[model samples]
Target: MSKFMVLVKQLYKQKVSAKSFILTTLLYLVVLAGIMYWSEIRDLIFSGDADTIAVVNETNFDVSEVLQNTDDYEYEYVTAGEVAEKLKDGDYYAAFTLTDADGKLAAKIESYDPLPLNDQQSFQGMLSQAGQIYAMSQLDLSPEQQQLLLSSEPIITLNSINEAAADGKSADEKMAGVWISYAIGIIIYIFVATYLSIITTDVASEKGSRALEMLLVSVKPEIHFRSKIVGVFLVALTQFIILFGGLLLLLRFSDGGNKWSIVTNLLDSMSIGYFLYVMGFLFLTIFMYLIIGALFGSLVSKVEEAGQVMMPAMMLTLVGFYVMLTGMGNPDTMLIKVFSYIPFTSGMVMPMRLGATDISAIEPIISFGLLLGTVLALYFLSLSFYKRSVLTYSSGGIIEKMKTVFKVTT
Candidate 1:
C-alpha cells in the first residue's frame, strides 16, 4: 500500500508538472472563460458603435412612436431622395422607405450591410402596428377604444404541476436546471473522451518503452494499475478545478450589470443538494471511464494502437451524450425513462431528468445504485483483465488483442 501511494504521488506530480499539461490547462481555461463572457467582451469592444438606420417617410402617417430605439440601433429620419444617397455613401447601416401601398403601409429596406434578424423583426412589428392603427381609425372607433384595442392582454402565467411545486422553484429555476444538466452532459462527454485518450496513450507509451516491465518487478500489477488510475484522475481533477475556479473568479469580479451572466445565473439556480448530487455522479462517471480506459490501455502493445483500443469506450460515451441531448426535448418518454436507468447512460440521463422534470426520490436512488454497482463490477473485471494481460505483448489488432486477453483469463 505504501509503495502504491508513492507510485501514485510520483505519477501525479509527473503528469501535473509536464509542459503540455500546464499549457493545455491554461488554454482550456482561457477558451471556456472566453465563451462564457463573449457577449460582455463584444459589448466592451463595440460599446459606442450602434448601427444607424436612415428612415425615409413618404406617407404623412405619424408612426414614429411605434419604432423601437435602443443601444443596438439609432434611427435617422430623412427625405425619400436622401435614402439612396445615404445608403450608397454607406453613411448608414440601412435605409428604409415607408410608403402608402393600396391604403396600407409598405416598407422597402436597402442597406450597405445586411440587417440582423432581430432588427428586421423589429421593423416588421413597427409596420404591422402602424397598419393596425390606420385600420382602426378607418373603423370610426373612438381614441379610447383604439387605445384599448392596441393594448396587449395580460400575460398568462404557467406553473409546473410536478412535485417541484412544493419546493417553490420558478419556471426560470427549472429552465436554469435544464441548461445546467445539458452543460453537465456535454462537459462529461468532452472530459471523459479527452482523459480516456490520455490514459490509453500514457499506458501504451509506458509499455512501448518497456518501463512497465521494470516497474512490475517492484510492485504488483494490481497496485501499479490502480495507482496509475488514481494518478491520472488527480491530474484530470486538478485541471478541472483550475478551469472552473478561474471561471468562477471571472464571474465574481465581472460587471454585475452585464446581461451575459449566464454562468452566474445557472449557479444561482442550483441548490446545494442538487450541486452535490451532480458532483457525485460526475466523479463516479469519470472514475468508471478511467477504469475502462486503463483496462483497454493495458491491452495495447504499441502507443499507436491507443486509439484503436479506446474506440469502444469512446463510442459508449458518444452514445450517452447523444441520448442525453435528444432525450432532453422529451424527458417523459418511455425510451428516455428506460435510458435513465441504464448504467452506462444514467450519469448523463438521470441528472437531465431530475432537472427537466419531477422525479421521485426512489428513481434517483435506484439509478444511482445501479450505476454504483456497474462501476464496481467494471472495476473488478478490469482489474482481473489487467492482471492477466498487462505484461503480455501482442503486435496484433484490437480484436486480436482482446481475444488474447480473454483467452489468457479463461
Candidate 2:
C-alpha cells in the first residue's frame, strides 16, 4: 500500500502545479457555459407559439370557419378584395387565400416574414382540412361527419425494426444518444491527448535537461521505463475513474425530483446490461490506448519527434472513430459484426452501434477479451521499445525498432 501510494504521489506531483490545474478547470468551466447557452437557445426556439396569421375570404368562402376549427394555429379573418396586397402590406404574419372551383377547395398562404417550420406545417394541414370540409359539403355531408373526416384516427399498431426507430426517437432520446456519443468521444479524445502529450513532454524534457544520465545509474532502463508507463497509465485511469464516478453521481441526482432532466432520462433509458458492456469497452480501450501511447512516447528522442512516432496510434484512433460513424445505420450488417471483433476500432464502433441498435451480449464479451489480449501484447512490446529507446535515440521505422528490441542481428 505504501509503495502504491508513493507511485501515485510521484505521478501526481509531476502535473500538480497550480497553473496546469487551473487551466484544466477553466477549460471545463467554459465547456459548461457553452452547454448551458445551447440549452437556453433550444428551449427558446421550441417554446414559441406560431405567429398569428390572417385569412382573406373573397370567394364567399368562410376561411375563418375552416381555420378556426383546427388546433394547429390561430387565424383571424378579414373581408378584403386584394388578399395578396393585404398580405404584402404586413397586416399579418401570413395570409392564406381560399377559393372554390368545380366543388373543390384550393388554398395558398403568402407570408411577408420568414415562416417558422411548425407554422408552415400547420398552414399546410389547415389547407388540407379546408379542402376536405369543402369537398364533404358538396357531397351533402353534415357538420359532424365533416369534422370526423377532418380528424385523424389514432393507430394502435407500431412497427419498426430499429431501422425505422433510427428516426423515431423523441427529441430528448435523440439528443441523449448524440450527447452520449459526443461525451464518450470527448473522453477518448482527452485521455489520448493528455497522456500522450504528457509522455512526449516527459521524454523530451528529461533528454533536454540531461536528467536521464543521473536516473540511469540506479534503475535499469526497463524498470524506469515500465515505472513511467505504469505511472502515467495509472494517473489517467485514476482521473477517469474519478470523473466517471462524479458523472454517475451527477446523473443520479440531476433530476432534483423533477423526473424530467436530460441526465435522468439518460440513466433511466439505459439498460443494465448495456451499461456494463459500455463500461467494459471504455475500460479496455483506455488500457490499450495508454500502453500504445506510452510506447509511441518512449520511441522518440525529443517532443518534436513524438508526433511522428505516435502516427500509428493516431491512425488507430481515426479508424476507430470512422468505423463508429459508418456503423450508425447498418449495425447488424456482417461487415459491422466483423469490425466489432477487431481490437483497435472495436472500442469506439461496437459501443456506438449497440447504443443505436440491439447487439447480442456474447459478441461484446468476446471482443472485450480480444482487446485485453491486444493490450497485454502491446504493453510488453512497448516495454521492449522503452528499454532500447530511452537511452539510445535513433530514427527508423517501428519494424526496425522491433528487430533491435528482440536483439535480432543479421
Candidate 3:
C-alpha cells in the first residue's frame, strides 16, 4: 500500500512537471478565461474611439437626447449643413435625420458604408421608442391613462393550466437549461476522448519498452497499472482546477457587466446540490474511461497503437451524447430515464435529466449508486488481469490480444 502511494506520487510529479503538460494547462486556462470575459476583452480591444453619429433634428423634439449612447456610437447633435460636411470628412459614422413627414414623424440614416445589421436594428428599436414617447407626451390624456398605456405586461394574461410547466422556470431559464445540457454533454464526450488518448499513450509507451518490466519487478503489475491511471486522472483534475479556479476568481472580483450577468443568473438558478452531484458524476465518468484507456494501452504491443483502440469507447460515449441531445428536447422520455441508470451512458444523460426535469428526488441518488458500483467493478476487474495484459506481447488487434490475456488469466 505504501509503495502504491509512492508510485502514484511519482507518476503525478513526472507528468505534471512535463513542459508539454504545463503549457497545455496554461493554454486551456487562458482560453477559458478569454471566453468567459469575452465582452470585456472586446471592449478593451475595440473601445476608446467610438464612431460619432451626427444627428440632424428637424423636428420640434430632440431625438438624440432620447436615445442612449453605446460604445460603438456617440451621438452628436449637428446642423443639416454640418451633417453633410462631417460625413464628407469621415468625422461621422453616419447621419441620422429626424423630421416631420406626411404629417407624422419620420427618420432616415445615411452613411459612407452600409451599417451593420446589429447597428441598424438598434437604431430602429430605439428610434421607434423615441417616436412613441414623443407622441405620448403630445397627448392630452390623464395620468392614469398614460400609466395604463405604459404598463409593460401584455393586456391579455396567460395562465397555464399545468402547474409543472409554470414552476418559476422562465423561457430564458429553460433556454439556458437546454444550452447547459449541451455544454455538459459536449464536455464529457470531448474530455473522455481526449484524456483517454493521453492515458493509452502513457501506458502503451511504457508497456512497449523494457522499463515496464523492470518496474513490474519492484511492484505488482496491477498496483502499477492503477497508480498510472490515478496519476493521469490527477493530471486531468489539475487542469480543471486551474480553469474553474480562474472562473471563481473572476466571479469574485469582476462586476460581470450586463451580458455576463445574464449568463451567471442562468447558472445561479440551479441548487448547489445539483452542481455538486453533477461534478462528482463527471469525475467518475472520466476516471472510468481513463481506466478503460489504460486497459487498452496494456493490450497494445506497440506504443503507436494507443490511439487506434479507442473506437469502442468513443462509440459508447457517442451513444450517451446522442441521448443527452434527445433529453434536451424532452426529458421525460423513457429512453432518457432508462439510460440514466446505465453506467456507460449515464455520464451525459443523467446530468441532462437532473437539470431539465423535476423527477422524483431519489432517482438521481439511485442512478449515482449504479454508476459508482460500475466504476468499482471495472477497477477490480482491471486489477485482476492487468499483469497478463502488460506481459503478453502477441501481435494482433486490441480485442484479439485482450481476449488472449483474459483467456490465460481465467
Candidate 4:
C-alpha cells in the first residue's frame, strides 16, 4: 500500500509539473474567461461604429417621433434631396424614403454600404409602428383601442403529459438546463479523452524505455498500473476543479446583467441529487477508460505505437460526445433512452436525459448498476491483459498483440 501510494504520488507530480499540463491549464482558463466576457468584448470592439440612417418622409406622417436612436444606430429625419446627396457623398450609412404608394405607406431603404440585418429590421419595425399609430389616429380611435389593436394575443399554456415533468422550471430554466447538460457533457468528453491519452502515452513511453521492467522488480504490475490510473485521475480532477473554480469566481464577480449570469444561475438551479448521480456515472466511465487505456498502453512495445493503441478509446469518446449532443435536442427520444442504459454512452446520455426530462429513479439506479458492473468486469480483465502483456516485447499491431495476450492468458 505504501509503495503504491509512492508510485501514485510520483506519477501525479510528474504529470502536474509538466510544461504541457501547466500551459493547457492556463489556456483553458483564458479561453473560458474569454467566452464568459465575449459580449463585452464584442461591444468594445464594434460599439463605436454606430451607423447613421437618414429617414426621408414623403408622406405627411410626422414619424420622426417613432424613429428612436439606439447605441448601434442613429436615425435622422431628412429631405429626399438630402438622401440622394448623402448617397452620392457617402455621408450616411443608410437612407430610406417613406412615401405613399397605392394609398398606403411604403418605405424604400437605400445605402452606400450594406446595412446590418438588425439595423434593417429595426427600421422596418419603426415604420410598421409609425404606420399603425397613424392609421389609428386617422380612425379617431382612443389610446386604449389603439393599444388593444397593437397588443399581441395571450399566449397558450403548454402542458406536458408527464405530471412530474420539471413542474416549477420556467422556459429559461429549462433552456439553461439543456445548455448546462451540454457543457457538462463536453467537459467530461474532453477530460476523459485528454487524461486517457496521457495515461496511454506515459505507459507506452515507460514500456518503450524498459523503465517498467526495472520498476516492476520493486513493485507488482497490478499496483503500478492501478497507481498510474489513480495518479492520472487525480490530475484530471485537479484540472477540473481549478477550471470550474476560476469560472465560478468570474461568475461571482460578474454583473448580473451579463449573459454568463444565466449559466451561473442554471448551475445553481440544478438539483444536487442529479449532479451526484451524473458524477457517479461519469467517474465510473472515467475509470473504465483509464483501465482500458492502460491495458492498451501496456500492450504497445513502442512509444510511436501509442496513438494507434489509443485510437479506439478516442473514437468511443467522440461517438458518445456527438450522441449526447444530439440527445440534448430531444432527450425523450427512444434512441437516447436506449443509449442511456449503455455503459459506454451512459456518461453523456443519462445526465442529459435526466436534466431534460422526468426519468424514474429506478432507471438511473439500473444504469449505475450496469456501469458499475461493467467497470469491475473490465478492471479484472484489464489487469489480466496488463499482467500478461506488460513484459512482452512485440513488434506487432494492436490486434496481433491482443491476440498474443489472450493466447498467453489462456
Candidate 5:
C-alpha cells in the first residue's frame, strides 16, 4: 500500500508540475476570464468614442435627438452648408446628410474614407430607429400608447402536459438542460483531448525508456496500472476543479453575474434526479475514455507511436460531440434515440434525454446499464493486455502491434 501510494503521488506530482499541464491550465483560465468578462472585453475593443461625426439634418422634424453622442461614435449636428468645410478641415471623421425622401427618412455619408462594416451597420440602424420613432409619434396617442407600440416582441406561454409549468420552473429546466448538456459534452471532449496524451505518454514513454520492466519488479502490474490511472484522474480532476470552480466563483460574484448568470440558471434548473443522472453519465463517459486512452497508450510499444494511435480515440470524441449537439437541438428524433444507447455517445445523449425531454425513468435505466456494461468490458479488456503490451516491441503499424498483442494474450 505504501508503494502504491508513493507511485500515485509521484505520478501526480510529475503531471501537475509539468510544463504542458501548467500551460493548458493557464489557457483555460484565460478563456474562463474572457467568457466571464466578455461584455467588458467587447466594450474595450468595440466601444468608446473614437471620432466626431457631422450630421446635417435637412428635414423639418427634430432628428437630432437620437443622433446624440454614443460610446461608438459622437454626433455633432451641423448645417448642410458646412459639410464641405468640415470634411476639408478634418473636423469630422465622417459626415452624414439626413433628408426626408418621399416622406421616408434617408441618410447617406459623404464620399470619404468609408467606415468599417460594424460602424456602417450601427449608423444605418440608428437612422432606421429614428425613423421608426418619428413615424410612431406622429399618431395622436399618449406616451403609454407609444411605448406599447414600440414593444412588439412576443412572449411565448407554455402549454405542455407535464407539471413543468406548474411551479414556473419548466422554462428554467428546459433552457438549463440544453446549456449544461453542451457544457458537459464540451468539458468531456476537452479533458479527453488534453489528458489522453498524458495517459498515452505515461505508459508509452515509460515502455520506450525500458523503465516499466524494472518498475514492475517492485510493484505489481495491476497496482502500477491502477495507480497511474488514478494519478492522471486526480490531475484531471484538479485541473477541472480549478477551472470550473474559478469560473463559477467569478460568474457568481462578478458584476456580470447579476445579469448574465449561468450559475444561477444551472441551480434553478438542476433537480435532484437530473443532477444525479447527469453526474452518472458524466463520470461514466470520462472514465470510459480514460481507460480507452490507457489501452491505446499500452498499445504503443514505442513513445513515437503514441501520436499515431490517437486517431481512433479522437474520432470517437468528434463523432460523439457532434451527435450530442444535434441531439440537444432535437432530442426526440430517431438519430438521437439511436445514439442515446451507444456507449460512447450516450453519456452526452442520455443527459439531454432526461433533462431536455419528458422521458420516463425506464429509458435512462436501460441506457445507463448498457454504458456501465461497456465500461466494465473495456476495463477488463484493457487490463488483460496492459502488462504484455508494455513489454512487446514490434516493427509495424498500430494495427499490427494490436494483432501481436492479441496473439500473445490469447
Candidate 6:
C-alpha cells in the first residue's frame, strides 16, 4: 500500500512536471479571461439604442404618443415634403404613416430592413390598443362602461402555495444548469485531450527511447501501467477540482446577478442537500470518465493515432452533452434513462436530468453509488487491458487483444 502511494506520488509529479504544469496553468487562465471578456464585449458591441423612428400626421392621430406609450422605441414627429422625405432618407430606422378613417384610423409602418417578428408584434399591438381606445371614446357608453370594456388581466400570473417564494431562479441560474452541463462536456474534453495525449506520447516515447524494455526489467508492466493510470487520473481530477471550486467561489460572490430567476427560484427551488449531492455526483462522474478515457488512450502505438482511438470516447461524451442540453425540457425517454445509468455517458447526462427534474432525493444517491461502483469496476478492468497493451506496439489487432485481456480477466 505504501509503495503504491509512493508510485502514485511519483507518477503525479512526473505527469505534472514543471513545464507541463506551467502550460496547463496558462491555458486555464486564458480560458477564464475569455469567459470574463465575452460579457463585456457583448455589452460594448450592443450598447445603447441607435433606433430612431419618424411619424407623419401624428397630431390628430399622433403615432409618437402611441409608440411612446408602449415604451418600445423613441420617436420624433416629422413634417412631410422633400425635407421630410430626405429626413426619412437614411437616418431613421423606421417610418410610420397614420391617416384618419372617419371616426376610425388606419396605419402602416415601413422600415429599410425587415423588422424582427417580436418587434413587429410589439409595435402592432401598441397601435391596436391605441386604436381600440380611440374607438371606445367615440362610444356613447359611460366612463365606467368604457373602463369595463378596456380592462383586462395580465397574460401571466403566478400564485405560490408555499409561504416562501422568490422571484425565482434568474436566467443565469437556469442557464447555469445548461452551462454547467456544457462545463462537464468541457471537462470531459480536457481530460480526454490532456491525458490521452499524455498516454500517447508516453507510449510513443517509451517505444522510441527503448524505456519500456529497460523499465520492464525492474517493474512489472501491470504495476507500471496501473501506476501511470493512477497518477494521470489524480492529476486530471486535482486540476478539475481546482477549476470547479474556483468557479463556485467566483459565482458565489458574483455581483453579475442571476440570469434566470424567473423559471425557478435559484435558492428556494432546490434543496441545499440535493444540490450538494448532485455536485458530489458530478465529481465522481468526471473521475470515472477520466479513468475510462485513460484506458483507451494506452493502446495507441503513435501520438498521432491517439485521436483516432479517442473517437469513440468523444462520441459518447458528445451524445451525453447534447442530450442534456437540447432535451432538458423533454420528458425522459428510455435512451436518456439508460444513458443516465450507463458508465460512459452518465457523467454529463444524469446530472442534467437531476438539475432539471424534481426527482426523489434517493434517486441521485443511488445513481451516485451505481456510478461509483462502475468506476471501481472499470478501473480494474481497464488496468488489466492497460497491463497487456502498454508494452505491445503492433497496430492491426489492438482491439482484439483488448478483448482477450477482458476475456481472461472475466
Which residues of candidate 2, in runs, are more than 4 Å off? 1-8, 16-21, 41-186, 237-266, 396-410
Error of 1 at 186 (Å): 2.3
User: What stretches of model 5 exceed 4 Å from their correct place?
Assistant: 38-51, 63-68, 80-97, 101-103, 107-127, 152-155, 161-173, 256-262, 325-337, 352-361
Q: What does candidate 5's lDDT look like per residue over 65-118, in tens digits?
A: 778776667888888887787777877888888787776777788735767888
Instruction: State the RMSD for candidate 6.
Output: 6.4
Per-residue lDDT of model 4, residues 1-410, tens digit only: 49999999999999999999999999999898887777777788988777788888888777767777777778888888778777768778888788876557788889876778887788788788887777666777887988888895877566677875545455555666677778878987998899889999999999999999999999999998899899999998889889989988777665664646666577787788888987897788888899988999999998899999999989988888888888767777888888888888888888887777766778888988999999999999888778888988777778999887777767
lDDT of 5 at 143: 79
lDDT for every model? Answer: 0.81, 0.65, 0.80, 0.84, 0.80, 0.63
The lDDT, on a scale of 0 to 1, for candidate 5 is 0.80
Instruction: List candidate 4 segments past 4 Å from native.
Output: 56-68, 80-91, 95-170, 256-264, 408-410
Question: Model 3: runs farther than 4 Å from truth?
Answer: 35-40, 54-62, 77-91, 94-151, 154-191, 256-268, 315-342, 394-410
Better of 3 and 6 by TM-score: 3
Tens digits of per-residue lDDT for model 2 on 250-368? 44444353423656668666557667877777777777776676666665566677667677777777777766666554545676677778887777767765665555556677888
Please give the TM-score that candidate 4 achieves against the real structure.
0.85
Top lDDT model: 4
> Local error of candidate 3 at 43, Å?
3.7
What digit string (tens of lDDT, one per residue) describes model 3 on residues 1-410? Answer: 58889988887898889898788878877877787677788899998878888888888875655776888778888888877777878999888898876546688998887889988998888888887766765786776876777776755534556655524444555566667777878878877877888888888888888678888899888888878888888888887787678766765555545545766787897767778878878999998898888888888878877777777888889899998888878877999999999999888988877787766568889999998998999988876767778887867777788888877767
TM-score preference between candidates 1 and 3, better one: 1
TM-score of each: 0.85, 0.68, 0.76, 0.85, 0.84, 0.68
Clash number for every model? Answer: 0, 0, 0, 0, 0, 15
TM-score of candidate 6 against the unseen true structure = 0.68
Q: Ten consecutive residues with minimal summed lDDT in candidate 3?
A: 164-173
Error of 6 at 323 (Å): 1.4
